[model samples]
Target: LKMGEFSNGLFGCFNNCTLCLITYIAPFGIYFVAKTREKIREQKGIDGGFGSDCLVHLFCPLCALVQDAQEIQPAAQAESMARE
Candidate 1:
């Protein structure tokens, strides 16, 4: 992935319906989205602030969550495999 670029589109949530459904149904889903966004920014060394993250989640929360999930899913899977 390149700097400031996501591997998936904003509305690509359907690509991973499980994640999308979880994010949509879970009460603590906002927290998960926030953390995921932080992880993505940190891993990619992208420039942004928590305030912006909050605003994004506060507004287009689902799309942001889906984007974050798509961005990190592969990395998380790879790390899980590495540990095993």
Candidate 2:
């Protein structure tokens, strides 16, 4: 699954400086929850159960966002390709 540099650990904070800054400060939980739900819908999950999900978001929040984007985007691209 291809993801934006801003969303990959290797190229994350280095590329998305502004976002990382914000994440470092706030670690927006609402955004994380929404992205998590989107990933769940795509059937690309980080693991079920509310507690684990919350822990991942509460701790490594940037990585969580990156993960959700990475998981959902590739599947979406594949589905679009299949339709074509």
Candidate 3:
């Protein structure tokens, strides 16, 4: 959970700096989420499952990344408008 928050905060910093792209950030976020879940499963001796608690913790950051990506759409559209 803390890892997810850290990843999210990092993403937010990248977004604010305009240094990261969704194409890159999304997969990295997913990878971290998977790794966290794997660690939790190992620690708890549980088979892999949905793990709603973990997902709940991760959802907000993931949503924020998606929202940030969506924000680029209007900018792209404006660029296309100018090109025409």
Candidate 4:
């Protein structure tokens, strides 16, 4: 996950909490959360999968960052290719 800056206050405390939560808690919990939600959604015959809220709030940013990193990678690769 990409790290962001933090400052002091309630917001900062919450941010710190979320950072820790995502780093420690989310990895273990997310899989089960997604799986259970998926099963429920499937049983309910919903078209969309689980974690839409979380996806919008968390995964979307990560996805965009990944895309940005991927875009930069090709240019870096090209530069390395040229150097060789």
By TM-score, the better pick of 1 and 3 is: 1
Model 4 misplacement above 4 A: 1-8, 11-59
lDDT of 3 by residue, 59-81 (tens): 66576345434655677899999
Order of the predicted models by TM-score, top scorer first: 1, 2, 4, 3
TM-score of 4: 0.33
Error of 1 at 16 (Å): 39
RMSD of each: 15.0, 11.4, 18.6, 13.7
Candidate 2 wrongly placed segments (more than 4 Å):
1-46
> What's the TM-score of each model vs. the native?
0.51, 0.47, 0.29, 0.33
Per-residue lDDT tens digits of candidate 4, residues 1-84? 989754576545465776767755446545554555455447556566456623532456556345445645787899999999
Give each model's clash number.
0, 0, 0, 0
Candidate 3 off by > 4 Å: 1-26, 49-84
Per-residue CA lDDT of model 1 for 4-26, tens digit only, reads 87888999988999988876754
What C-alpha root-mean-square deviation, in Å, does candidate 4 show against the real structure?
A: 13.7
Which prediction has more favorable TM-score, 2 or 3?
Answer: 2
TM-score of 1: 0.51
In angstroms, the error of model 4 at 52 is: 18
Q: Give the clashing residue pairs of candidate 2, or none.
A: none
Which sequence of candidate numbers ranks them by lDDT, best first?
Answer: 1, 2, 4, 3
Clashes of 2: 0
